[model samples]
Target: MYVIYLRKSRKDSDLEALGIDVLKRHEETLLELARARSLPIGAIYREVVSGDSIDARPEMVRLLSEVESGIWEGVLVMEVERLARGDTIDQGRVQRAFFYSNTLIVTPGKTYNPAIENDNEYFEFSLFMSRREYATIKRRMQAGRIRSVKDGYYVGNIAPYGWRRVKADDCKHFTLVPDEKENPVLKLMYDFMGNKKYGFQKTCSALTGMGIVSRSGKPFNPATVKTIISNPVNIGMLRWNYRKSQKAIVNGKIATSRPKADDYILAKGKHPGCISEDLYYRANSVNSSMTAPVKRSCRIQNPFAGIVRCSCCGRVMVRKKMSAKQPRDYLICQYAGCATVAIELDELENAVLEWIRNYIADYKVNNFESADDSEQESLRSILVNLEKEKETTLKQRGSLFDLLEQGIYTKEIFFERSTALEDKIKDFDKKIESVNADIVRLDLSKKNRSTFVPKCQELLNAWDTFDAADKNTALKNVIERIDFTKTEKNARGQRHSSFSIDVFPRISR
Candidate 1:
């Protein structure tokens, strides 16, 4: 039996320009090739995923797994490169799987039997050539994008909300044009922030009430409103490279990170301003001033400043000094005419800490009978698999060096292959470390009540020694909010208050 595999690479601009019809033609071509070769097609695997990496393609992974079962005599594709154009590890995996299964790779150009030494080398060379081609194309595209950015043209597909894109006279670059509908909403947002002094939530609510939707055609959220207000594009300026971004595939999804601020290029864009520069600055300045911390000479740090909320008005409680002589702080509700009682900082901290200590003690007692043994077992299994993968990668690296020494591989190919394998080994090492950490955490969780009790006690002791910042972090981690009611004076003239504390422990119950 044989399987026919078809893949469409999004990086091929020519193929994309031809539309969905081209994909049908590609499949027909492969099918005709298989029919002419008298190969039996058991199944067909097709996907439209970019890049050569198997991580991005579910069908490729299924095909490789099926091939490994030795159920298929071979896989038929248009060309050898269709199997893989990824890094060395993926290329090696495909080759080795076919070699071990004694399957042939059938292409219109030739049939490659991985068990044959010459055929195996030819297949590897094809994959290497494909990888080089992919790298070159990627580099060219990235260079073009950077050049476009430097030329004051929009390189991205979608323009910011409230803007439309029009091709420049060159027909290769894009310029932003104001969207008559969204641009008015954008100006209204600036007006709300600067002139009306409406905060993000209030502005979002007002926009939603006015039936103004975001780019997704959904009611405007605070985040969407804030992005429009904060963006510099509204002022007819283009800002690029404000932050350095790195992309990685995590659990089959592309995750991006902007680690730190980098050098930024700001240029006047070829677009009319939706809002004046003065309005933009004024709006942002007002937002910053409203959010600034209360001034103090000694910089008094209150752990529960923002977390505490009024039980009556459900508004955030603000920190205020009780008296100049007392030197004590209290969290008071800022809502007008709210009778919610003020909470002394010391009293609130003591009450929260005591509750946490008791909660941890009770959790330890209750969970002592039910350990996370299943999680530990799962971690052990993952660690074993990771170790095996690491060993296989190391062996492959050593084999590559042997091939280099035997003059079977040129220095350039040898270095490229070795570097790729080293990267795989590094990724495996990271996974192993992460698994080990999980196992350790599970082990601690499964410890006896006596052992667990001491850990909780140590945590309590650590709180006493923590600085104001650390204390604040600890409070935020364990307690969600502390609500207070008005204090009452007893017949004996003693003041008493009640609190409703919302505790959210870090550990699961």
Candidate 2:
């Protein structure tokens, strides 16, 4: 018995445009060929997915498995390319599976018996030709896509949240037009995060509460909100080739890493921007300031959720409520083997507040002697030095251009020197900004601290009124980590514990 294996080419856009009927015709043609050859077709394995790799197509994998078991005497296909159009490794696997099973590969034009050396040679040669053709077609398609992107047309299928995909005038390329229904929601999201200082989770909750669903008709998720906010496409910028390399099939799916800043292809898009560049960056900066694990939605407003670590096992301490009727929250070590005893959440909060108050008292006493004017003068001197270095780099870059024009430097050398100078200028620019920020902070410190202590005290006093996200942010800004360990019980059986808190003051930028 013979199995008829059929596959539609992934790169065949013409066949896809003609619709499913064209693929059906391919099946009919293969059936006709089998009947003419007088072969008993046991089962027909038809795959609509692109036959790029053996792992990518499930039907193909099943076919190979049955063929290797010696269940079928031969395999019938339209062509050898239908069996494999992948790299040498996949092609070799297909060839060896047939050869070891002593199966015959029957195509329309000829019959290839893998047991025969000559036929096996012809089959291998056909696979090689198919691989070469696949490479050629892949290159042409990639070149077309690059050209399409450079021409300011949207090359991807799915448009971003605020945009709708539309066919261009030429009917060959696509463009993005603003989706009327979603644009208003997108604008509101940006305003909430950038202008209102709302976190991603809070903003997502607000949108979902307002009955704003995503394209899938599901409630907005934090990941979806983050993707929309951080996307440069909203600012009328197209970013392509952001992956460092081509995707590799890992666990039967495409996986790739982000490319470096220099490798990205960024261009001004033809579509109108939904948010200003300033708003985009500001929202992204706020999102970036958050700790990694804090991006999710938290049900309980525990400021010390991720910050509190188990002293014994170094695992994060989780907040567990004892009962629904008389709820008493306690911070317990998440690890099963950790011997750390549970501490009441209220007791922990009180300890943290006391530490903050003591820190403020110490700051007020020690900071009085250090004059802010002297610090400002020092920062100003550093800023002046950075400005001079920036000027020198700019002059060096200007000289390189002149040297290139005067034939004093080759194109390669000029580019090398220019890149070095450009990098130097960027470094100087960052240092200058840092110094200026320090100067501003120094000037503000003198006046702000007079009211800072009172404001902090008020924040701590009303901490319960703040939401979970706000409390988390405030704790992260103030405290680095709080170590807790239980002490031995006294003769009266009274247990006592020691708390060590590491405090980091919030720096204004």
Candidate 3:
């Protein structure tokens, strides 16, 4: 009994471009060899993908597992090297698989019998040579990539946001072109972070408030906001080997990871920059200097943790618990050199309720529409367009691999196109999701309109009985933030003082 194992090699890519079916050719040759010797072919394993290790390649793993069972008399391949060219351990594993099974390694050139000492030694030597060749090819590719980066070409698999990857008209290399729609948003992201001195969270929130969304049509997140503002690519720069790939054995399986590295090649790119270098540097400085988020506590302390801010310094007002002598909780601005005076929490809460009542009056006067049939109809129209976009993106994605195989796109270009298409498809899906959510929210808003005033009144009535966390959550559901201004602190500790409170409601009214 015998079996055939097949996998495409690196050289096979070029052959594929030449319209040669390398696998089929190998298969025919091997089949001819089998017929000449009158050997019976029991099974055939064809690997449709490429991977660096056995675990990464499914068919190869199954072949080795079966070979280890010693069920076959021989394992036929186009070349002995095709069986294993991963690493020394992998080659040794392949060597041992045949040696222990006493199976012959069959190729078109010659047959290697594991039982013979000379044949086994020769087979191992062939596998080692194949590994060396593979390593050399990879090293060359890496060197080429680095050279491309140094020459101001964009060799990355995906283009940075606000930019599109395009092959340079005058040269063989690829470069970045600004995306009209995304370019403005990318610039605004920088403006928010650098010029306005907003943190990632605030920048994302501001963008969402302005109805700016990612290609996926979802609200921008902190991580995405940071990536966009901090990326030197927006300033016409390229980063090479920023995070180098690290390979290790994890739980008896090969795993690859790329960890953040401080040292990397940062060169000026050929692409036109979207933002100024000053903006780029400033945003990064703010990003690094910002404090980390506080972890959630077991018990809630402040009802207005996020919703209250110091009007002077623009920092979130912190809850300061008084000692036994003071007997009060004050929301204080913690910024150094800030002139903002702290106000007692009791006084602030009462002011917030008064403001809520005023807001209810204003809402009624304005006669704002909570749910509109026309708005839902508009959302439905947007949803249909998003679905169409997703369908087109998916279709483009389907042909990307074929283009790569046909040599229509280089490996780098293929990756960029694939990533862009995938991102577009994901964005469309999210946009569709967001539209659906809007429709549902409109339906909920109809029910919610009558409940709003009662909800606020109930909270005001039950303020003392409610838990700190419960109060905070209730306030956050309606209020965006409460700006507090107090320039002069009272010489005498007064619960009631000349302090001002400005409540920013989440609702439009």
Candidate with maximal lDDT: 3
After superposition of all CA atoms, the RMSD between model 1 and the true structure is 16.0
lDDT of 1 by residue, 241-276 (tens): 666577888897667777535567677776767898
lDDT of each: 0.75, 0.77, 0.82
Query: Each prediction's Cα RMSD?
Result: 16.0, 27.1, 20.3
Number of clashes in every candidate structure? 0, 0, 1
lDDT of 2 by residue, 1-509 (tens): 99888777755567778675655777788789888888888998888776467988998899999989999999988889889988898899899999999999987789999989999999999999999999998899888877777777888878988989998878878888889998899999889888988887678668877878889886675667888887788988787776546566789766754544576677777777878989888887664312234333645457677788777767677766556653667776543234576776777778878877786787777774276777787788888888887888888888887899999999999988888888888888888888888887777776666556666777687787887567777777555677777533224434344545444445321
Query: What tens digits encode model 3's per-residue C-alpha lDDT throughout 87-116?
Result: 988998889998998989888889999999
* Model 1 residue 400 lDDT score: 92
Residue 60 lDDT in candidate 3: 88
Candidate 1 steric clashes: 0
lDDT ranking from best to worst? 3, 2, 1
What ranges in model 2 sit over 4 Å off?
244-262, 288-509
Scanning candidate 1 in windows of ten residues, the lowest lDDT window is 287-296
Q: Give TM per candidate.
A: 0.61, 0.57, 0.54
